[model samples]
Target: MSGAVSWIYLDVGLDTCTQGHDCQHICINNGSSYICKCQGGYVLNADQKTCSRSDACTQGHECQHVCLKNGDSYYCMCHEGYVLNADQNTCSRSNTCAQGHDCQHICVKNGDSHLCTCHDGYVLNGDQKMCSRKNLNLTLTFEMHVVVLIHVLMVMIASICVNSDKSYICMCRVGYVLNPDKKTCSRKKPRSSDTCAQGHDCQHICVSTDDSFVCKCRMGYVLNADQKTCSRKNSDLYKRHDVFATVF
Candidate 1:
């Protein structure tokens, strides 16, 4: 008899918020338990006990780079080498190098754009950002000559040679992209099936690239410290005017 009584008390228990909860704003009734919910303009955090600001990046916030909240309002911030537009919302690229633009050697401005150049005796890498010592070895020279010949040949074949590293890379022209072979510039279709290797298991989205793949977060979520994981944005940034529950 006690075993049956104990099962009802422990297994199918019911202390579900009948005596109030630690939820900052409100508590919701579940099937056999309860959950905490934040008020409007707020959201519950991963802790499941505290509440933080929500709608931080909504309608009013049109920040170009990042959005920040202060008190009951929100503001915008610009990245380095950028200036806030007159509207105080958007950002525009600035010519000043400052802490922006990853350049290993020197930076030069041409019109509104900038270029990265290496010092003498150094050559720009494939990324056009870092620099390395120029390799003028005979073998490398022969490769360059071979690259030129291949480029000319590609032009005759309705293709283009954009890379000279090791051998070449077929730079597909507009309305065209490289086929699975990475050599044939096939006409671009409306959409292509995701061919990412099985077991990619990205949280939200996975984008395939020439070299590898990129993982991206979904809307209303931000990439966490671990690039593969995601978390609700503004969930921990609320302070002023936001009454949060303390886990005492």
Candidate 2:
């Protein structure tokens, strides 16, 4: 036999092929080469030497019902009590009640809503948005007028009573008596016969109802019943009346 190149035995009980021999459709190991199989969720490259991630979601290319696309994968989520607006990235809640009702109290706006409450000194009306005045029937203006009128009348009566008291005191002054008219006082004067210093005309005289007398007259009169004394009325003229003597 001609000289034959001996085949080398590789490690681990494997017969190694000689260089430049073709092995069809089977894996061959070189000094540092090894074969690997693609796992789940991964795909082998066309040469079958490497693996890459298999994006299953992107393959379908469609998301249903609250699912969103992120890169090559899909994520599922729902809006927070709201919905995406025409621009899918933005969200919006309803604001139909934002301005609230047209009433007395203030309207408070909350997220997506509003409510109504009464202001001070008022109560909520049937509509819940309006407020009506408290004590609606009470009339403060009229009550004030009535109180003022009463006070004025009381002041007027007090003034009249005060003036009447002063006038009554003045009427009781000395040498005066209450007139039967009750509005005046008059001096009590004696009759002509009882006048004092009855020579000249008496200027004034006061006689008590008890038959006593006080008199004022011009000079030259003697006290007598008539205001004119006997010496003044008739020089040496004497007249006599019942138990009384007078100069005539």
* Highest-scoring model, lDDT: 1
Q: Which is the leading candidate under TM-score?
A: 1
TM-score of each: 0.30, 0.22
> What are the per-residue Cα lDDT tens digits for candidate 1 across 51-86?
988756664677889888865568898987678989
Per-candidate local distance difference test: 0.70, 0.49
In candidate 2, what are the lDDT values of residues 182-242, reduced to their tens digit?
4344566755564333443434434433344554444444556764343344434434352
Alpha-carbon deviation at 6 in model 2, angstroms = 8.4
Stretches off by above 4 angstroms in model 2 are: 1-83, 93-108, 111-113, 117-122, 125-135, 138-248
Each candidate's clash count: 0, 6
